[model samples]
Target: MKYFLLTTLVSLAFLTSCRTLQNTQKPSAGAAHQSQEQQYKAAVVSKAQTAQCVTAKINMDVDADGKQISCGGSLKMKRDDVIQLSLTFLGFEVGRLEFTPKDVLVVDRIHRQYSRASYAEVDFLHQAGLDFYALQSLFWNEIFTPGSRDVRSQLNRFRLAASGDYTSLLLTDAPKLNYQFLTRTSSALLDRVTVDGKTAADQGQFVWKYDNFTTLGGKLFPTSMAVSISGMGKKAGFTLALSRLNNDTDWPTRTTISSKYTQIKATSLLDKLAGMAQ
Candidate 1:
């Protein structure tokens, strides 16, 4: 009777081991799907980044009452290089905006005005109510090698949640931004960014819309942008439009004007303006 009991126990153990091995050999379908999705996203980003150069036209409209503005312009972005944007409003020259990893320049040939700033100057620009960090982050991979501490963290913070039919992502910080990126089948792209933070009563909460993305050199870029603030009527919104994109050559930077002094002056000016407006 003892032998019989021992044989029965051995049989049960063998069956249990076989079951474990079978389970280990098979991966869950959900895990496999997720792996495939990750691969696809990596491929999409790679392809989007490799398109040699991108050039497109853009336009911009601002509506405080509507809480948004639309704008479009022409943009040319070279792979792992710089982006040059030529802006025009109503057939009149607005200016040209250029961005590199270390610098940003806005040259207004019509007004013979130029403004230059460095990455560190971003904080100053933000304080001056002229933040362009979004533009910098958008073409970050092209401007830089993409592994620096600043760029790496930024990249990881904003990821491609979905692409193809329509693109969407979740931004890490400032949830009040309520940022959303979407691209249509026709290659048009739209970005809705909200600014929710403590501000003086005059500024209040703001929601900005950057829309009407067009393709240039096979890459998509925003052409129109609008900014609207709470309590301000729609007519008070700001709008900008782009007329041309020059990717055929490089922009001369030897004569670029630094904004170091302007930034300091802007601080005092902003304080005065804030006081007066209040």
Candidate 2:
């Protein structure tokens, strides 16, 4: 169960190592080529322009290397501010994961241990371009370009295409990564995002899928998500089913750690995950 909590946090950042689009009639055959592209860019970007905060009770289920565990928790986030998840078992709090602009924090209450590190200090996250805003966008169900807080300004870099029943937004500008976002044409909702390594040395892909949409803060938001990563010689993922979601902004954004808890190196957290999977 401890490992499950830790893995859940890593997957949210590393696994996202991880989309938006909308519906519009196919442009006329003679229409300007970018006409359809422009419409999608507008529709997708508009979905995220208004949301700034979110809070929810989450039922988290994790499956990594064929081991599974279920836990309950709450998730809280404020755009560009913080993202936090609390884990509990048998009505007792056990662990917590928090991400802020400056660093990532993980606490294991049962073990009296914790770790904190800046984004640049985490090798896997840095190599995959999974920063605070990028991970936030993934949770908020928005398309994003690596290192940019807003994807609107970079729409020109994405190639939009409608195929069969889905609209795809593809970005190939990352040094060794390719990002693809897909929306179902029928529902016109951003449903999935995939990141694939471009070189043999960095082989593997991350797939994040959003589902179970409901209205939150007057906007359609996904209340469930499934994140899976494969290749790189290992497979892991987690699913979150959220309930009682609200756009509440009343909670504190930062957590205080006790001096008595042992501080471990951030890299050790990754090693613990690797050990758990084996």
Candidate 3:
């Protein structure tokens, strides 16, 4: 169960949290006349103007196999470059999870060890077709296709379905994964994203739900997010309650891992995190 935490962190990036929007209006008659594809395209355009950089202080909770750990954390993201999540306890840093264009790095501060691996070295991530940009969309409150940096060219491949008050866009071309995004039918704000595995080896589900939206950079950004994962006869997930969000981009994108820290295999990262949390 502890090992799956690495998968959970890599797969569940940013999520929605904060104040809910109560007054978003329905589409106009002109918008109603547009095809589902066209309407979705417009929503994509509207959400594309995301923040170039974001920094937030986070209260995070991790639950796995009936064990729960809570910590103070921080989130920092620079668009197209890096996303970093740092965990602390008693005001001292305990662990760090970082994603860059080239690799994923997990630092176990308490153990003075770290693990670094290419994205391809992560099995579930490689199978799900997620990359840096796709994970960036989750953190930045935007929608995305798996392999493409931009979703515009891939619009036609998504199938839309309306159910009750929300619309779902399903990716039909994903062979190893089933990915879906749900948005409010009235305002087109993204509400949830679900990804499920299609095969036995990849038999798990990842759910990222958004709510309590507040305006950031003139956009409706989710300040709180809940992520849940269940698979392989075990369950593990985390929630990030974010505060003090800002567009601060002054920090360096890359962190230099010190030679004093001994490098460890990526597979042992979550084990170290779980032990540290206890």
Top model number, lDDT: 2
Worst-scoring 10-residue span by lDDT in model 1: 15-24
Q: After superposition, how far is residue 165 of candidate 2 from its true place, in Å?
A: 1.8
lDDT of 3 by residue, 1-278 (tens): 23434434533531111011111233334545447567665685486546788898999887665667788879999988999988887898877878988988877777677888887876545655667887787777677777788787777666677779988776646655566788888878888877765544555667778888877887777888887766535566678899998889888788789999999886665454445333
- Cα lDDT, model 1, residue 123: 45
lDDT of 1 by residue, 151-190 (tens): 3334434334444575443332431222333333233233
Candidate with the larger TM-score of 1 and 3: 3
Rank the models by lDDT, top first: 2, 3, 1
Model 2 segments beyond 4 Å from truth?
13-31, 200-202
CA lDDT, every prediction? 0.40, 0.79, 0.70
- Summarize candidate 2's per-residue lDDT along 1-278 as a digit string, tens digits: 67767676655545534321223334345457678667777788777727678999999888776778899989999999999988888888799989898999999999899999998888778776678988888888999988998688888777776789998887776776778888877655788988876655666678889998999988899999998877746667899999999999899999889989999998897787656555
For each predicted model, how many residue pairs clash, with residues at least 3 apart or on different chains?
24, 0, 7
